[model samples]
Target: MAAQYDAVIVGAGFGGMGAAIQLHRLGHRRLLILEREDDLGGTWHVNRYPGLAVDIPSATYSYSFEPNPHWSRLFAPGAELKQYAEHVAEKYGLRPHMRFGTVVTGAHWVEEESHWRVAIAGGDSVTATYLCTATGFLSQPKVPDIEGIEDFGGKVIHTTAWDDDYDLTGKRAAIIGTGATAVQLIPEVAKVAADLTVYQRTPIWVSPKPDYRIPPRLRRLFARIPLAQKVVRAVGSGLLELLMISGVVHYRRLRIANRIAERYCRAHLFRQVRDPELRRKLTPDYSFGCKRPTFSNTYFRAFTKPHVHLETSRIERVEEQAIVTADGRRTEIDVLLLATGFNLWDVNFPAIEIIGRDGKNLGKWWRENRFQAYEGVTVPGFPNLVSLNSPYSYSGLSYFTTIECQMQHIDRLFRAMRARNAKVFEVSQQANDRFLELMRDKVGDSVFALGQCATANSYYFNQHGEATLLRPTSTRNAQREAVRFPLSDYTYA
Candidate 1:
């Protein structure tokens, strides 16, 4: 007989941990968290490249229930995030339930048993009453399809799998992609590399990062008075909502807000880069918030350095020790760094093969029809399953907000299930369709629908040219709906 668990959660990241913690609180103790990585922290553990830190303010980045008042900076470094994850796991007793280096191949619903049979990589399987996939939005790394990249003789490294031991000091380095990750990394690499070339396919909108070290006195006050920290978190969240959430997600209603944000970013760029041509090259052709914007003080300044070269030409191919461009320009480098982002719609949509009722494949169904989930948690065909990183799931600027909102949804859902003595539950097709329509209508008013996003090449927009990732609503509204959503939406057994 396979090992049995009340709930089996794939991916032992913060999302899995949060799910486990919520389940434990609901009196469902038989849990197992499967992680492909050797340890926890998910992306925090996977990404260890220099200049890695949370783009959002640290105050708002963490779980609202458990806030860390000891962050060294307003925007804590990646190491601090790892430590925070460890602290959460230890405090919540999640370690024993987690199995590290465990690969989950797929899962299928067993109708007769009314349970999920989760398959492991080595032909072994586990039975769970409920299955939750929290594999994260950016779990799978995307390798660029540039010709002759495989034949490159020099050291090639992807940001996801950074080799910290291998020093880049005195070495010529070329970084491809200028997304949020590249924005943070380029400045650091420019400081050390003998010659640094930044390959830009699309210019990123970058604002001045108001990063500062938290004074010891302030930290002490926060540790002593938790409410003080809560106030700070509120302020931080409000700013993020006004700038990112409203300016971008609510672009139709808040066009002026978006323009103000765009002007601010442009002004920041102008202030940093003296050369008009360089500033123009750095400016994005697409509307602001078409792609995700990032905060970086040093990113613009890095290009002004003598050894740092910004290459705007399209990449033709990679030679043994040189990168050739479409403009017949060739640049030789000792190390090639791929800051290319993740494969979202293709590989990471479901993150794993999930077979639902009547031989319905979840991935296939979504691709064939549309990517959606009722309330961004439960689907119509899949019973007793919650996809944490589903379409229209991400509510606010902070991921913690999304997690907490989903937790609320799960808590309310499970409470209803327990009250009715139900063993199985699935979202109704009517509910799913209604929710999908609501999201479509809401997103129709956003920047993705109204603005110039053709040049953005953003992951937010899927293969269908629909921005299905973020929930086009405020954090408070998401939380309210999670708790107050009608129970009749789901059919319980």
Candidate 2:
């Protein structure tokens, strides 16, 4: 017989940990968390590249239920974030339920048994009445398929898998892709590298980050009066909510925000880059918020450095010791970096073969159906299975908001199941269809759909070019929907 548990969570990240804590508090003690890596913290555990920090304010990045008063800066570094994750886990006593170095290969719903049989990578199996996965939105790295990349003689590093032991002092480095990851690391790399070449496919609109160190006095005050930190979090969340409303939810009604963001971006660019040619090259052609907005203070300044060269030519191929452009320009470098981002908004990383009722593979079903989920958690055919960070479920502002909303949603479902003595529960196809229809109706007016995002090469859309990734609702609205939504939308057995 396989090991049994009341619930099996396929991650140890924020969402998974939050779910575990909520379930534990709800008297569901038979819980297990499986983490693929040798430790917790998910992305923070794996992404240890230089200058890695939270783009959002530290006050808002954390869980509202468990506020941290000891953040060192407005934007906490990756190390601090990892420690915070550990702190939360230890505080909730989640370590006892977590199995490190365990990778889930697949799961199948056993209708006759009314349970889920989860298969581990090493042939071990586990049985759970409920299965939840929180592998995260950008857990999978998107490596570019450039020609001759494998034949390169020098070192190649992806931001997701940074080898800290590899030294970069005085070495010629070439960085590819200018997304969020590149903006963060390029400045730090430019300082030490003898010469750096940044290959840019498309310029990103970057806003000035108001990052600063949190004073020890403020930390002490927060510790003394927890309400202080709560107030700060509320304020931060309010600001981001307004941003979301302008940029995502009510973009049509309030498009002045685009002008404001663009104005700031252009001013910042002009202030940093003295050369008109460089400034023009760095400006984005599309409307603001068409792509994900980035915040950086040092990325622009890095271009002004004598040792740093920005290459706008399209990459043709990679030579043994050089990167060749389409214009036949070859840049020599000792180190090559890929900042191509993750396979977010397209597919879940470390995808499991989820065999639902009637032998329907979840991956295949999504491919056929164009990736629709009932509130990004429950599916029609997959009974007793809940997936986190699913399509049309993601809120743009903060992951904490999403996690809290999802945890509350899951908690409500479990409570409903317990009240009715239900052994199995699944979303009705009607409910899934209704929710998807509502999302499609609402998304037509949102910025992602109307804001020229189709031309921006963004990850917000699926293969069909529909903006199905973001939830067209505010965080507060989502939270309320999670709690107040009727349980009759699902069928229980």
Candidate 3:
């Protein structure tokens, strides 16, 4: 006999926790949260590399329902965020409902039983009436396919899987991939390593981060009046919405901002790096916001250091000792750091074989249909299943914005189900197609579609070269649409 649950949520991270909290509040009983890891705080717990911090402002990154007045810095560190996750779990009594160290390997819809039978690792199974996968977009870490990568005798570490025991001090370190993680880790690695070489595949647009600690006076005021924190978050969100509109959505409208951003980058590069040649090498040729934009005040400054060297060449292969370049230059490295990002659009889903209607694999369906979801929540064939952080479902600069919107959407669907006395809520294929059509129309005008995103080699695009990852709308529009959209779009049975 399988343990039964009203709802079974996957991945106890921000998305999972948020879903659990919302479901519980909405009167869901016998809900279970299955976390693969022994603990919660999914991404925050895993990526513990040096100098790791949230790029977004701390004020906006948090949930609107629960605002913490005691964030130590404007850009909170990984540990603090992890503590915050634990705090949320403890605060809401979510720990009791969570089954840590439990991995859900597969899920099959029991059409006759009108429930989902989930197969777990270690020979266990569970049944749930409602299934919500909050597995997250960036959950799976992507390692580059390079020859002799496994043959490396030295310590080769990915930023996602940081070995706390491994020391980088006085060792010749080489960091591959100059994306967000590299931008943060390089400066910290340069501080300790004897010599550091940053191998850049593509130059990314990095803006200055205005990060500082919140004054105790302000914290006290936020604690005294929570509205104060809400106001701050609202203002920041508004500003970010404008950025998203002009820079991301309107596409061509970002010319002015692009000029300003490039100027700022050039000025910052000039101020930080002494060598003109190095500065030029660091400068990006692509337009701003082509790929995911980054922020770091110290990354460029790290290059000014004598021990740091920037190598922008095709990596020939990964030898036991050195990373050889196309031009036949080999740099000896004691520690190899891979800042290579996640498997975003490449079958990035819950680590479970989900068999929907008629034994249709959700993974195969997604790949076949180009990853379409009805409002990024429900698939046509997957009855009573909701996916948080799904493709084209994700919007807003802050993930909290996306989570909140998703929660609202889920709440609406739940309310609809109750009102109609529906046992199943599956979106119609027509509805899903219409939603994708709208997204396609909106994305056509966005920088991701019209801009240099294709050449930028961004994860925003799938293997099919379609920009279906991000919701092509402003945060406010996305939120409003998710909440107020027509429920008739889905079929209630």
Specify the highest-lDDT model's number. Answer: 1
TM for candidate 1 is: 0.99
Best by TM-score: 1
- Candidate 1 residue 108 Cα shift, in angstroms, is 0.3
Where is the poorest 10-residue window by lDDT in model 2?
Answer: 344-353
Error of 2 at 75 (Å): 0.5
Ranking by lDDT: 1, 2, 3
Clashing pairs in 2: none
Name the weakest run of 10 consecutive residues (lDDT summed) in model 3. 344-353
> For every model shown, what is its TM-score relative to the native structure?
0.99, 0.97, 0.97
Task: Residues 1-493, candidate 2: write the lDDT tens digits.
Answer: 3338989999998989988998897888999999998999998888999999998899999898888899999999999999999999999999999999998999998877878899998889999988888888888888888999999999999999998899999999999999888999999999999999999988888988989999999999999999999998888888877764566666777777667777988999999999999998899887777677788999999999999999999899999999999999988999999989988644572266789898988888887887788887888899988888688777757888888888888888888988999868899999999999998888877787677665577777677788777788777788898898789998988
What tens digits encode model 1's per-residue C-alpha lDDT throughout 1-493? 3338999999888888899999999999899999999999999999999999999999998989999998999989999999999999999999999999889999999988899999999899999999999999999999999999999999999999999888999999999999999999999999899999999999999998999999999999999999999999999999988988897878989999999999999999999999999999999999988898999999999999999999999999999999999999999999999999999999977999999999799999999999999888999899999999999998887889999999999999999999999978999999999999999998988999999999999999999999999998878889999999999999999
In order, how many clashes per candidate?
A: 0, 0, 0
What are the lDDT scores of the predictions, listed in order?
A: 0.93, 0.86, 0.85
Those runs of model 3 whose alpha carbons end farther than 4 Å from true positions after fitting are 1-3
> Cα miss at 337, model 1 (Å)?
0.5
